[model samples]
Structures are given as C-alpha cells and as structure tokens.
Target: MTTISKTRIDGMPIGLTLALLLACAVNLAVLARWL
Candidate 1:
C-alpha cells in the first residue's frame, strides 16, 4: 500500500506538467487562429 501510494505521488507531478503543457498548447493554437 505504501509503495503504491509513493508511486502515485511520484506520478502526480509528471501528470500535472503534461496537463499544463497541453493546456498551453491549446491556448496557443486558439490565439494563433484568432490572430
């Protein structure tokens, strides 16, 4: 149980980073289309 929780904690930052990057890419695409 501890190991599983540790792995999940480790994965969270990577997931968050990916989500932020994806959001940034989507925002940039929208801005480009509007401009």
Candidate 2:
C-alpha cells in the first residue's frame, strides 16, 4: 500500500491524490472514533 501510494504520489492524477487524502482522513476519523 505504501509503495502504491508513493508511486501514485509521484505520478498519479490529482483525482487520485484527492481520493487518497480522503481515504486517509476517513481512516483517521474512524480510528479516532474508536479510541
């Protein structure tokens, strides 16, 4: 996942970047809620 994200970061489209950011934000939010 890290490898793919890194590559996406390097050459992926802005849409993908936004999607990745959104995914991270959702993950963090879920973790925060759980904790």
Candidate 3:
C-alpha cells in the first residue's frame, strides 16, 4: 500500500485515507476469519 501512503503524504484528505485504512483492515480481518 505504498501508493496509498504516498497519496496520503501528498495531501489526500484525512477522512478518505482513514476510510481506506479501515476498509483494508476489515477486509484482512474477514479473510483471516474465513481462512
């Protein structure tokens, strides 16, 4: 997720960045649960 981080550093809005991070975390959690 270097691209995401770069975008965040490049001044992407905080809300959108937080949403993306939250979504990623949720997705990983779901996958871990399923596996």
Candidate 4:
C-alpha cells in the first residue's frame, strides 16, 4: 500500500520512509517483548 515517489531530499530515495517506519515498528516489537 506504500508508494515510492520520484521526488527526494538530498538524493535519498522516498522509499526509505517506509523502511524507517518499518524499523520503528520492529523496535517497538522488541521493546514490547522485553517489557
């Protein structure tokens, strides 16, 4: 459901936004498991 856009900042690809979001989700999952 995510769309990668051609426009970007400082040459970084827009697709990375989803990757960052997923990384946050994984971090939360690990935190939940630890808690």
Among all candidates shown, the one with the greatest lDDT? 2
lDDT of 2 by residue, 1-35 (tens): 99986886989888988998999999999999999
lDDT tens digits by residue: candidate 1, 1-35: 99996787577888786787799999999999999
Candidate 3 collision pairs:
none
lDDT of 3 by residue, 1-35 (tens): 99986976669777877888899999999999999
Per TM-score, the best of the predicted structures is 2
Task: For residue 29, give model 2's deviation from the true position in Å.
Answer: 0.2
Q: Write down the lDDT of every candidate, Cα atoms only.
A: 0.85, 0.91, 0.87, 0.71
lDDT of 4 at 9: 34
As a TM-score, model 4 comes out at 0.60
| Candidate 1: C-alpha lDDT | 0.85
Using all chains and alpha carbons, the TM-scores for the candidates as numbered come to 0.64, 0.72, 0.71, 0.60
TM-score of 2: 0.72
What residue pairs clash in candidate 1, if any at all? none
Model 2, residue 18: displacement in angstroms? Answer: 0.4
State the displacement of the C-alpha of residue 13, model 1, in Å, after optimal TM-score superposition.
0.8
Better of 2 and 4 by lDDT: 2
Candidate achieving higher lDDT, 3 or 4: 3
Which has the higher lDDT value, candidate number 1 or candidate number 4? Answer: 1
lDDT of 4 at 7: 42
Per-prediction tally of clashes: 0, 0, 0, 0
